[model samples]
Target: MVGDYDSYFADRARRGAETSPTSATTEPAKTAPAKPRNAPKSGLTYKETRELETLEKTIAETERKIADIETLFSDPEFYRTRAAEAAPLQKELESLKTGLDDAYARWGELEDKKSGS
Candidate 1:
């Protein structure tokens, strides 16, 4: 029955889906530690300080990636020759933007907690 299905229905599995376990040699990606910021206020705990710094770093990285994607989108030649490639990048750009918004919200919450302490 598998062979009888239409191509569209037969290929319903999403592209980029991982189908196998990664090899042992594939080390997990390591991000550099967030850059040092102005020392946290006296009221902030060490854990809170670390979390805020990491959030700031995440926000910065996400914004940079989003800008890079936007620049690519602005170049007409990119779309003209590689429109197929744009869909994945656009999806990634949207995800990054959403993450950035969440990061900003978390940062705000952290700030509020720091102030409340």
Candidate 2:
């Protein structure tokens, strides 16, 4: 009886091995189609676009001021004569940066709302 059972299992195993592909060389199964790459039809409204543009311009101006301050601080003569002059510009730049950050956060919130997130 044990021998008969062993032969029965061996036959079942052989059948299973034959039905399944043994080699990894077989082509992979087909995948689902990819999602479209285009952005959704929805986008920023005209007012939001204008606000973003304004914020971007202000940020650019602030960046220019920071660059000028850095250059002035690097020059020994300017540091001695005009370090005080750069202080207010530096403070204004910091305030602009904070405003820029707030504007960006607001933009993100608006985008999420528009996207129905």
Candidate 3:
């Protein structure tokens, strides 16, 4: 009786259903696209880019000078002969340090404006 009942229901379901072909399936809906993992855009203009490049080059050159000064300071003979070396490098480093501070302040101002703060 159970076998007859099961077969009867199965046959009835198959007969009642309309036979149709399945279409290609698709993935479930997603929330949103992934964001890029990078530093936020500064929205700097062309002039800003040129200024930054110039400042960065100056800073790099100053840093190299500082490194050379340090090397000279380490050597007794060079330290005596190049006593004048440290003064200029120190002055340039201080100037570059001020430039970096100004750049950071400008960047902060830009960021604040962008955030509507």
Candidate 4:
């Protein structure tokens, strides 16, 4: 009764249907992405991979802060009269921008080395 998947069997047994054959068979085959013909011969070293991951995380966090600052800027009063709020937002925006610049520079350096440029 447990493996019986037919509607009639489920109804008769008052239990859920068994896993469908199609469900088990429906998973897409896993495949690696096609590499460019001129792609780098050497793969990323462990340190480079770790640094890229860390930089990506830092960039994402900085972007989120920028988005928060932008949202705060959307209010007219934020720009006109809310100097205190605007001050912090402006400072944060600058910091995040600097962070983005540094992250991009690091990424560019890593990519140039990887591609033998």
Candidate topping TM-score: 1
Clashing pairs in 1: none
Quick one: ranking by TM-score, best first?
1, 4, 2, 3
- Estimate, for each residue in 1-117, the C-alpha lDDT of model 4 and write its tens digit: 255468666576543235455567798888999977995467578899799889888888888888988887987877778767787778878988988998989988878777767
Residue 74, model 1: Cα distance from true site in angstroms: 0.8
What are the per-residue Cα lDDT tens digits for candidate 3 across 24-56? Answer: 244557779888799656566677656656766
Q: Report the C-alpha displacement of residue 8, candidate 3, in angstroms.
A: 97
lDDT of 3 at 31: 75
Instruction: Please give the RMSD to the true structure for each candidate, in Å.
Output: 28.9, 10.7, 11.6, 18.5
**Candidate 3 clash pair list:** none
- Candidate with more favorable, higher lDDT: 1 or 3: 1
Candidate with top lDDT is 1
TM-score of each: 0.60, 0.46, 0.39, 0.54
Candidate 2 lDDT by residue in tens digits, 1-117: 256888989988988888677655577899999998987556678887787678667767766766776777678998677767777867876786787678678767766756768
Instruction: Give model 2 RMSD, 1 decimal.
Output: 10.7
lDDT of each: 0.84, 0.74, 0.66, 0.79
Q: How high is the lDDT of residue 39 in model 2?
A: 77
